[model samples]
Target: MTKQSRLIFRNKIFFRLWMAQSGSSLGDWFNHVALAATTLSLTQSPTAMGLVLLCRDLPQVTLSFLAGPLLDRFSKRLMMYISDLVRALVAIVFIWAALEQQMWAFYTGSVLMGIASSVFGPARNATIPGVVAEKDITEANSWTVATSGVLSVVGAAFGGLVSTVVQPAIAFAVNAFSYIWSAAWILITKWKEVTREQDKEESSSYFAELREGFTLLKENRIIMALICTSVAFAIMSGPYFVMIPVLGDLIYNLGGIGIGLLYVADGLAFILSASLVGRVVGNNVTSAHRWYGWGFVIQAAFFVAFAFSTNVWAGMIFIFLSQLGAGILLTLGMTILQMTVSPEVRGRIFAIDHTVDTGVKQLSLLISGPAISLLGSPIVGMIVGVIGGFAGISWWYVSNRERKNVSQTSEPYQI
Candidate 1:
C-alpha cells in the first residue's frame, strides 16, 4: 500500500479502534438477522418485526440529543466500553429468550440493546478524529465506511445461515460474544482520559449544552443542509430493509437465504464504491461535496430501475448498484463532519445527525406496512424514487450556488 493508505493502519490506536468497530459492526448485523428471524418465527406478524425495529429506534429519537451532552462531558472510551458491555448482556438476553421461548423477553432485550446502541453510535463517531492525524481524517472515515460494508457482507450472509440452520439463539450467542470481544478491544486502547475542566468552563448546565448544539446547527448553513440531505437519504432508502424480505420470499421465492444475498450484494457494492470515492475525493472538500450531491442522483436512478425490474435477479443487481451511491454519500458526509466540526461539540453534532438519520429510517419502517398495504411495494418504491430525485436536485442547486459564491469572491474586481 502507498504511504497515504498505510497511515491509518500504522497508527496503532486508530487501527485497534477500527478493528474493534469492525467486530462490533459484524455482530450488529448478526443480531439484526437473528432478531428479525426470531421475532417473525414467534409472532408471525410483520407488525411485530416493525415494532422490534421501532423499539430499537425510539430511544435514538428520544435520547439522541441527551446522549450528546453526556458523550461530550464523559470519556468516549469509557462510554464505548459501557455501551458494548450493556449490548453484550442484551444479546445474551435474546439468546436466553430464544432458548426459553419467551417472546416478551426477546422484545425487552431488543429494546435494551437499542438504548445501548444509541449511546455507542455517537460516542464511537465522536472519538474517530481524536484517534487519527488531522490530515488522515477523510482516509480514516473511508476505511471505516468500507470496513462496515465489507463486514456487513459477512455478518448478514452468514448470520442468516446460522440463524436458519443452527438456530437464531446460536446467532445471538455469537453476537453477544462479538460485543464482549469488542469491549475487550476497547479496553486496550490508550485513550487519554478527558477531564471535565474544559466542559466546566464552556458550559454550565446540561440544557445549555444541548441548546448550544442546536445553535451550531442553525448557524452553520452547510452542515444544516447536509443534515437535511441525510434525512432525505434515510427516508428514501429506509423502506428497502422492510421490502427485502418481501422481495426474497413473496416475490422471488428464495426465502431467508435470498434476503441474505441481497444484503451481501449491497454491501459488496458499497465497499467497492467507498474505496473509489476515497481515492478520488481524498481531502478535497469541494470534490467531496460535488460527489456527495451527485450520489443522491445516482441513488434515485437505481431506485427507479429497481422499482421497474420484474426479475428478482435484476432487482438484486439494482439494489447492489444503488448502494454505490449510498457508499459515496455516507463516506463523504461523515468525513466532512469529522473534518469541520469542533471536537468539543462533535459528539453532540454526531448525536443529532444519528438521531435524525436513524429516527427517520425507523419511522419509515414503522409506517412501511401501512404504506405498502395502501400503495403496494412497487408504488412505494416509486415514491421513494421521487423523493430521492428531489433531494438530489436540491442538493445540486445548493452546492452549485455555494461554488458560485466562492468563485465570485475569488474573481478580480470589475471596472
Candidate 2:
C-alpha cells in the first residue's frame, strides 16, 4: 500500500473498527443476494419480491426516530456489539426459514436483520469521528467506502454462485459467520465509556428528543440539502434492486450469473470512486459538494443509458458508471457530515440521513413494482432518469445558493 493508504491504519482503533465494518458489510451483501434470490424463487411474483425488499427497509423508516435518540444517549460501541449479535442469530434463523420454505419466517428474519442494521449503521457512522482526527476523515471514509465496495463484489458474486451451484442456505450460514466475526472485532476493541451525565442533561422526553433531531435538520441548511439530494438519488435508483433480478431472469435469461455480474460492475465502480475521488476531495467541503453535484448528473445520464442497453454486458457497463456517481455522493456526504456536526448530535443526524435514504427508496420500490408490471423496466427507468435529471439541476441551484451562507457560518473543525 502507498504511504497515504497506510495513514488510516495508523489509528489502531480506527483500524479495528474498519475490520468490524468489513465483516458486517460482507455478511450484508451475502444475505441480500441469498434472500433476494430465495424470495423470488419461492413466490415467483414481482410484488412478492418488492415486499421482501420492503421488509428489509421498513424498520429504518419507522424506527430511526427512536433509534436516533437512543444512539445519542447510550454507548455506540455497545450498540454495535448487540446489533451484530442479533443479526448473527437472525442469519441462522434465515437458513432455517429458507430450508423449511417458510416465506413468512423468511420475511420476519429479514425484518429483524433490518432492525439490527438500522442501529448498527448510525452507530458506526457516529463512532468514526470519535476515534479519528479531523485530518484523517477523508482517508478513513475512503478506506471504509472502498472496503465496503470490494466486499460487496465478493459477497454478491459468492452468494450468487453458491445459491446457484450449492444452495442459498449456505450463503445464509456464511452471513451468520461473518456477523460473528464482526461482533468479535467489536468485543476486542477497547472503547471509552461515554458518560451519561452529559446525555442526561441533554435528554428530554422521548418525543422531545425525537423532535430535537428534526430541529437540527431544519437548522442545518447544508445537511438539509444533502438529505434532499440523497432522497432524490435514492428514489431514482430504486428500480435497480427490482430490475437487476428481473432483468437477469426475464430479459437476459442469465439468472443469478447475470445479476452477479451487474453487482460486480457496480461494486468495482464504488471502489474506484471512493478511493480515487475520495482523496481528491479531501478536507475540502466545497470540493466534496461539487463532486456530489456532478455525481448526480452522471447518474442521471447513465440511468438512461442502462435502461436503453439491450446486451447484458453493455448494461453492466452502464450500471458501473452510474454507481461510480453513487459512490462519490455517498462517501463525500458521510465525510462532510462527520466533519460538520458536533459529536453529541452526530448519531441523530446520521439516523435522519438513514431514514430519508431508506424511506424514500422504500416508497420508490413500491411504485417501481407496479410500474414494472404495467410499463416495463425500461420505461420505468426512463421516468426515474428524468426525475434524476431534474433533481440534479435543483441540487446545483440549492448548493450554490447555500454555499456562501455555510462557509461564513460554519465553525472550523480541528484535528
Candidate 3:
C-alpha cells in the first residue's frame, strides 16, 4: 500500500478495530483444532465430526438473513461490541466442555459463536467505509487480511502445539480470553456511520427494508456474479471442517497435532499469499473477480495435490500452496464488496454474501463427511477438487471475457 493509503487507513478508529479483530482471529484456528480433535477423540466417528460442523455453520446460515437488516439500521460498532462480549461469555462453555468431554456443550458453544459471527461479519465489513476513505478502502481491507494472515500463522502453530502438548482446554481458555481482548479494543474504537434519510426516519417496516436489500441484490447483476464467485471458495474451504478429524483418524495419525501441522502450513501460506495479492490487486475493484477466479484455480490445483500426497509432511507443502490461493481469492472477493457496493446496503449484501459462502460450505461438509466414511479423505478431497476446479475455470473464463461478452456487461442495479 502507498504511504498515504496506509496513513489514512491506520487512523485510530481502524487501528483499534484491527487490534480487536486480531485478538479474536488469534483463537480461530485454535478453536477449529480443539473442537475437531476433541470430537474425533470422543466419538471416533466421521458422522459426529459432521455434526460439529453443522452446529458451527447452521446459525450463521439461518441468522444472517436477520442480521443484514439489523446491521443496516443499527450501530455496527455497538453490535460488534455486544457480539464480542457475548462470544467471550459463551466461550467459557468450551473450557467446561473440553474438561468434561461433552460434545453437546461443545456444539452449543459453536451455535452461540456462529450467531455472534453472523452479526460480526456484515457489521464489520459495513463499518469499514465509515472508518476510511473510499479510495483507501481496498488498502484498509488489504491491511486487515495481511494482519489476519500473520496472526493466523502464529495462531495456527501456537494453537496446534498447545492443543497437542498442553491440552485442548488451554486452547479453549485462550479463545475465551481473545474475545475479551477483542471486546476491549472494539469498546474504544470510534465509528461514524452514514445512513440514508429514509433509514433514519424509519419510514418502512422491517419487511419492506428487507425487501429493499433483496431487490437490490436480485437486480444487481454484478453483485450476484460476485456472490456466485464465493461458491468455489465455499467448496474449497469446506474441506477445513472435515479434514481435521480425517487427518487425525485416517491420514498421518498424529491426531490433533497433525491437523495443526496442516494448518500451520496453511497459515504460513496465508501470510505471504494474502499480503502479496492485496498489494497486486490493490484498488483494482473491477478486476477483483478475475483474480478471485484465478486464485481458486490455484487453490484447487494444489488441493488436488494435497489429496494425493504420500504423507502428512509432504502434504503440508501442498496445504500451504492451496491456502495461498485461498488467501488471494477471499481477499479479492471481500475487497470488491467493500469498495464497490453502496453503503446503505453493504451490510445486507455482506450478510447475503456470507450466507451463501457458509451455506455452500456446509452443504459440502454434509457431502464430505458421509463420503469420507464411505470412501476416505483422499477420494473425497479429489472429488471436491474436481468440482472446485471446474467452477473456478468457468468463473475465470466468464470474468476474463467480460468486455467481449454481452451478458457480462449488464449494468448493476442502481440504488
lDDT per model vs. reference: 0.81, 0.81, 0.76
Better of 1 and 3 by TM-score: 1
Lowest-sum lDDT 10-residue window in model 3: 406-415
Give the lDDT of residue 82 in candidate 2: 99
Tens digits of per-residue lDDT for model 1, 82-154: 9999999989888889988798987777778888888988888888888787667777877887888888877
Error of 1 at 251 (Å): 3.9
Please list all clashing residue pairs in model 1, or write none if there are none: none
Candidate 2 wrongly placed segments (more than 4 Å)? 37-53, 98-104, 193-203, 245-257, 376-379, 406-415
Badly placed stretches (over 4 Å) of model 3 are 1-9, 33-53, 93-107, 160-170, 199-202, 240-258, 312-314, 372-382, 397-415
Give the clash count for each candidate.
Answer: 0, 0, 0
Per-residue lDDT tens digits of candidate 2, residues 133-172? 7877877888887887898878777777898899889999
Candidates arranged by TM-score, highest first: 1, 2, 3
RMSD of 1: 3.7
lDDT preference between candidates 1 and 3, better one? 1
- The worst-scoring run of ten residues by lDDT in candidate 2 lies at 193-202
Models 1 onward score TM values of 0.90, 0.89, 0.83
Best candidate according to TM-score: 1
Which residue pairs in candidate 2 collide?
Answer: none
